[model samples]
Target: WDGVSPDRNFTGIENYTQLFTRPELFRVFFVSFYYLAASAVQIVIALYFATVLSFDLRLRNLFKGILFFPYLINGVAIGFVFLYFFQDGGTLDSILSWFGVGGDHAWLGDPESANTSLAGVSVWRFTGLNFVLFLGAIQSIPGELYEAAQLDGASRWQQFRHIIAPSIKPVVSLSVILAISGSLAVFEIPYIMTGGATDTSTFVIQTVKLAFQFNKTGLASACAVVLLLIILLVTWIQRRIVPDDKVDLV
Candidate 1:
C-alpha cells in the first residue's frame, strides 16, 4: 500500500530490498552507535553508583532518589526539558561558562555534537533504572560473605571482584541485553528533541517517518521487521556469550 491508495499491491521483498539498498539505512545505524556507546557508559555509571550506595554511606537513600528521579519523568518531557538546556545561552551554556568554557557552542544544532548530546541525554535518563537493578543485586548478597572477606583483609576492590561481581552476574547480563536493545531501538529522545534533524535520526525514527510522514507503510513495515531481526540476533548472541548458570554468591 502507498498509504493513500485503496488498491493493495504485493511487492514481495521489494520493500526489504529497497530498505537494504538505501544509503540512509547505513546512516541511521551509524547514529545508533552513538547511543550504543552511551548505553555502555550509562551501565558503568549506574553500577558505580549502585555499588557505592549498596555500602554504608551518608544520605545514601537521598542519593538513590536523586539519581532515579530522571527515569521517573516521561521521555517526552525529558526531551523537551533538555531542548532548552542545550539551546545556545541556556542552562548548560551557563554552567559551562562558570568553568571558563564559552557559551557560544551549539550543542544540538551542530551535526558533529548533536548525536553525542542526544546520547548523553539518553545516558542520564536511563542510568537510574540500571542503578536500581545493580543496587538490588548487590544488596541481595549475604552480609556474612562480606564479613568473611573482611576478616581475610580483602580490599574493597577484591571483595567486589570475588564476591559482588559473581553475585550480580545475572543482573549485569540482563542490563547489557537491555542496553543493546534499547540503543538499537532508540527513538523518543532524538525524535522529540531534534525531530531527526542534524543527522540525529535513528533507525526507529526513520521507520516512523517512512510510515507516517512519507506514507510508505509497506517500506516502514519492512524496516520494522529488519529491526526486530537485528534485535533478536543481538539478544541471541548475548545469551550465548552469557549463558544462564547458577551463580553461587557465597
Candidate 2:
C-alpha cells in the first residue's frame, strides 16, 4: 500500500493464492502455531497463579508486582534477558552446568531450539497480563458464592471446579482469543532473538520479509489480509461461544 501510485494492478486473490504456493510460508505458519500454543500454556499457568494469589495471603502486593514486572519492561529487553539466559555462560546455562546435566548451548540460534526459546520469552513477557485478567475475574466472583459452597461442604478444589470455572469461562475464552491473535502476529521478539529464522519465523515476520526483503508486496499484503481474517474468525467464534454480555447489558 506504500509508494505504489496508480501503476500497480490490484491482483486480488492472486496474491493470496501465492501465500499457499510459497515455500517460506511453512516457517511463518509454524511460528504462528508455536506462538499460539506457547501463549496458551503461559495463560493457563498465570491463571493458576492468580487463583492461588486470590486467597487472603501475605505479601500479595509483592507477589503481584513481581509477576507483572516483566510485562512492564520492554518485550525486546525481556527477549534479550532470555537470550542471555539461554546463551552459554549465562545464568540458566550455568545452572544447567552445575547440575552435571548439560553444557553451553546457543538455544536461540539452533534450528531445533530456536522456536522453543523464543516461545519461552513470549510466555514470560505476557504472563503478567494473563495473571491480571484471571485475578480480576476471580475477585469479581461473589463472596457469598464461596460461603454458600462452604456451607454445602464443598472443598476448595470442588469450589474451584464448580464456581470459579463457570464464572470465569468468558474471561478464559477472551484470553485465549487475545493470545492467539497477538501471538500469531509475533515479530519483535523473534526478530530480536533470531532474525526470523526459518524454524522460528512467524506470519507477521514473513509478511515483512516478503514485502521488504523479496519485494513481494502483493504476497505480503495477501498474508496480512489472511492473518486479519483468521483473527476475526477466531474472535467471532469466541464471542459466539462465550456470548457477549454487552448485548445483555444493553
Candidate 3:
C-alpha cells in the first residue's frame, strides 16, 4: 500500500538511495550464483532423465509424479522440510555421518554453504517440472528418425547429436528462458528458509525486506522495477541468441 501511495513521504535514505548506489545491496548479486547453478544442473538432469528413463510409459509416469510432486508443494512447506533436513544432526547429517563427514556442519548456518544449500533445494524442487518438459520434447521427436539412424549404424551419442539435440532446440530454448526468469524471481524458498539471512538473500527477498522490514516502500518499488527490467532484457537477449527455426529430424 505504501509503495504506490501518492501522499507518502519520500525522505532520507529510502528516497535518495537506490540498490545500485548501495554497495551492501550488492549481496543479492552473489545469490544469482545459486540460481544459475541450479538452473544448469536442473536442465542437464532433466535432459538425461528424459532421454534415458522415458522409454517405459508406466515407469515414466510414476517417476514423473514422484519427482514433480515437490513442485506441487507449497514453498513455505518445502523450506520447512529442507530446514529440518539440513539442520545439525538432521537427515543430511545422519546420511553424511556414515561417511565420517558433516556430522557437525550446519548446512544453513554458514554464509558459504547457505546459498549452496538453498540452490540444492531449488534444484530438487523444480527438476521434476523441467524433466517433464524435456521428456515431452524428446518424445515429440519422430521415432522413424531413430530407427533410420540405427540402420545407418549411428551410435546413441551420434543419434542424440544429430537428431535429439537439434530437434528439441526450441524446447531447450524455452526451458532456458524459463529457468533464467524463474531463478531471478525466486522468493519464497529463501524467504521462508533463511528469512534472507546468512547471505542467502535473493533479489526478490531483498525487495520484500525493503518494503515491509525497513518501510522503504518507494525503494522497494524501484527495486522491483529494476528486477523486471533485468528479466526482460535477459530474455530478449536469449531469444536473439537462440535460433527459432526447426531442425531436420533426419
Best by lDDT: 1
lDDT per residue for candidate 2 within 16-117, as digits (tens), equals 677777776744676676778788888889988888898889999899999988889987787777767877768888898788967677776676688877
How many clashes in candidate 2?
0
- As for model 2, its CA RMSD to the true structure in angstroms is 3.0
lDDT tens readout by residue for model 1, 180-199: 99999999999998999999
All candidates: TM-score: 0.97, 0.89, 0.90
Model 1 regions lying over 4 Å from their true place: none
RMSD of each: 1.2, 3.0, 2.6
Highest TM-score against the true fold, candidate = 1
lDDT of 3 at 136: 87
Query: Which is the better candidate, 1 or 3, if ranked by lDDT?
Result: 1
**Model 3, 204-223: lDDT tens per residue?**
88888889888778888778
- Cα error, residue 18 of model 3, in Å, equals 2.3
User: Which 10 consecutive residues of model 3 have the lowest summed lDDT?
Assistant: 9-18
The per-model lDDT (C-alpha) reads 0.92, 0.80, 0.83
Instruction: State in Å the error of residue 45, model 3.
Output: 0.4
